[model samples]
Target: MMTHWIKSNSTVFGKYLFVKGLSQKVNSKKFEVGKTVFQSLNGRDLLSFEGYTRNEVYSLLWVATELKNVQQSLRLGKRVGLIWSNPIAKASLTHASQNLESSLCCVHENQLFGSSNNYEMLGRSLASTSDIIFLDVPSWSQSNVEEFAAGSNRPVILISSRDLSPAVVYSELLSFYETYGFLRRVILVYLGPGNNPALNTYFTVFPTIGGHLRYVVDGVIESQASWEKGLRLATKFNTEIKQFEKVDEAIDRAHAISTCSHNLSHMHLKLKDVKEMDLDWTFVQSDSHKGLSVSKDLMKAAGHSLIHEVINNQSWIFQACIAAHTSDYRPIIQPPRFEGVD
Candidate 1:
């Protein structure tokens, strides 16, 4: 039998070197953090969250949050091209793009990644036509992402949930942290026994921003794997990894709780289990299909406590708009206060 993989680090081998090389290449072309958000983010591929500084992440959240404040058609004349595998990802992004008044030319993963050498031609054509591109293939790894990025000149946002390379899709978590000012205790709950690589993004990000993140695991194997992963991440980030055996206990300590149970529509959170948490405790249902992990009634009870209530598909919209220079307004980026809980 193959040995079970147990440890988690911020990046896979050579990923750091690859990102550094890309950064240097971009810098050679006069690519640096620009005065405005549009200039700063334009013509970049967000393959992974590995190279982003805490300030950059915070600035992005600020930009995305600010995009929702205005009713103006920011992306009116711009066209967005999306290559997506996940149906939920495609639908969520389509909805968000429509709301922003951007025209979309979408290609399914089967059409783009099929057995054909025309990927380069297709990518070039798409890049020429679209202002920005979104790649949401969950199966694509770091190398796959890099290859796509290299083929296209337009900005590429990798929004997939993959093991080898984590996406910036979870930056909505940081946006929540910023919007709430700060939350001392945060709980990340996954419904099933299998390991969700999406959580790796959260593990890497929360530490950089400085916050208490606790993981709640149900299965014995999962708990062990999670504990080992947490240790490795803590060592890598020089922070503490708080793992809890009981969901209710974790919920009790958490000021905010987010769930990543995508397909577990049958599994629901019981009211009695979470009744002890403060009335103001925040709940985030991160899945595109709402109420898959938590019941609709419990979410109703959450009331004002529920945040990012819908799957935040709009982050991609703001990112595309920034890259395409669709907005003229340059909002100030303010850093959030960093706090670590004991």
Candidate 2:
């Protein structure tokens, strides 16, 4: 019963990017997709090539395993909706979409390696499999959403970057988003000028009654990852609510450490040109019906340990990936979008 109120253009979580980036760099030079034989590498290839290397293998495990933990931490719970293109993108998203909480939409299904022309055929099948759907905002249309909405239960939708205001589309079908028993999460990516009044003006149309809305702004990764590796990072911040109903012993165990400064507003974030630091994160308490807050200094301190948590959580996801590898390669298409539907 947790929800993430994230807004921004780019926000990715966990150390998966660091490991995957390093692996990609190595694999880019070593393995050449179809050209390099699976057995050619002397030890291991970090980059993903179909299903051949340790990096690729473990990466999927990372997604299937760590995703659940991270989302649960944010209270996205067991069901999530992820939007990214390709198998690599699909696998990279493991951290957020793990277990049954995640549903994926390949926005550029037209570009999949072995894409098929039977668009509706794949669309109908995808509708049957997932409870929610994710789509690039520009590509989403009213007709397409309605067709899938016809089949889904508590479905979710995603729109990449603010290129297309969600209002134009959602305006036509306010009822779709407000459907009974459905909890749709709408994510808008704000790369920069994230606070444009034009976009904010349209916010009122989106119903909060049965949906979750988040603005995603990118945040600090490690200084090294952004500069040295050409990596992209986003904040995977968390909030802890003090529960009044919990046992007294547990309450006594809870503690908060104040930092030397409220650096929450400013940190010597590196590669400023290459990154965006979101200064605030909000936490909600269900029982108290009140909001809690944390300082930037506290965020910097707590976030420092993400790498360790990521490493420790890997073993189980890896096992799960290995078991599901063969069957996981099947194609999962996003339902088709209609042409020129307002």
Candidate 3:
């Protein structure tokens, strides 16, 4: 088979003529905004996970939060860590708190918050734009290759580019792996619109060597809000909704449901607070837990719970919130001594 290489800059960002031959096209410069000058990668190179455990779910949330802050810092040309005490339900993290900090060049909780920020004058050195965005994905050029090649536990080095054939990417990466063994695997994502079936199916053969954490295209078309399609697909896949492999899609729909539930009561609540407030009054009970009662206080808390236990125990955190707010939002409906957050 004959192979032809073409170089063209994306209209989305016309600063640099990038693509598979970016190293040659932008040979003069070290890095361009969206152009890394490394090499193109297949969409299948993106990492994917089942996300069926609390740890996995928690890690995703934590990573996303950190990535958001990192991206923001880069945009601002600053390198300060964001405070992380309030966004999530407090829980002990195994790999998140440290690994994430190192990855983002962030201050750990103790340094950022527990220690005085207002009192002590602490500042992080600004990172170069390219330092935050692009690098040689195979082995960082600025760093020690021997340190990276020491073991098989090397971290993921994502070099996102499009229009590169899988054979070229796989061959190049495979060469690097055999020589330096720097990256454990390749991670890829497409930034443009519409479905790229060819790119999406890039890693089907090398199942053990790639993933899709950033881009999991489900062919949703122009629809912004729709779970019926996902549900229907779930049925066709011969799997219960709870056991669907597309857990990210399930979580997205769950978020939509919870968002709709907020319309019933503009305010959110805690279960304990709801119970204390309604101690004397009577309300409808959930059919699943009759007599035990469902507190609409915050009808849903999804990400906090694990996947298997959620299905087995029949958790209705979100449903309860919807029911409670839908049923009544009047503060006067309280039974007696029910003090809420001021």
Best by TM-score: 1
Give the per-residue lDDT digits (tens) of candidate 2, residues 252-320.
Answer: 322111111112222112222112433222111110111222323433343221222322233233222
Q: For every model shown, what is its TM-score relative to the native structure?
A: 0.68, 0.25, 0.19
What pairs collide in candidate 1? none
**On a 0 to 1 TM-score scale, where does candidate 3 land against the true structure?**
0.19
Q: Candidate 3: which stretches are off by over 4 Å?
A: 1-97, 105-232, 239-261, 265-342
Question: Model 1 — TM-score against the truth?
Answer: 0.68
Q: In candidate 3, how many Å is residue 193 off?
A: 25
C-alpha lDDT values of all predictions: 0.52, 0.27, 0.22
Q: Which ten residues in a row have the lowest lDDT in candidate 2?
A: 282-291
- Report the lDDT tens digits of candidate 1 across residue range 1-342: 011122232222321211212211111121122222323544556665566655555555555555555445654556878887766667766766676677778888766645654545666778898877777776655566676677777777777635422343445554455556552234344343335555555556654544446655444332233334433444444443455556655555456666665544334575554565544455665443443576555766734334343345345444434433333445444423323222
Q: Best to worst by lDDT, what's the order? A: 1, 2, 3
What C-alpha RMSD separates each model from the true structure?
8.9, 23.0, 23.5
lDDT per residue as tens, model 3, 1-342: 111111122111222332222321222221111211111121111121111221222222222223323332212221212212211111111122232232333222344335433311221121221122111121122122222222212121222112112222222222222223221222222222222322322323122222111222333322211122222222222212221223233233121111111112222224564344432211111111221122343345332212122222111211111112122211112121111111
**Evaluated with lDDT, which candidate comes out highest?**
1
Clashes of 1: 0
Judged by lDDT against the true structure, how good is candidate 2?
0.27
lDDT of 3: 0.22
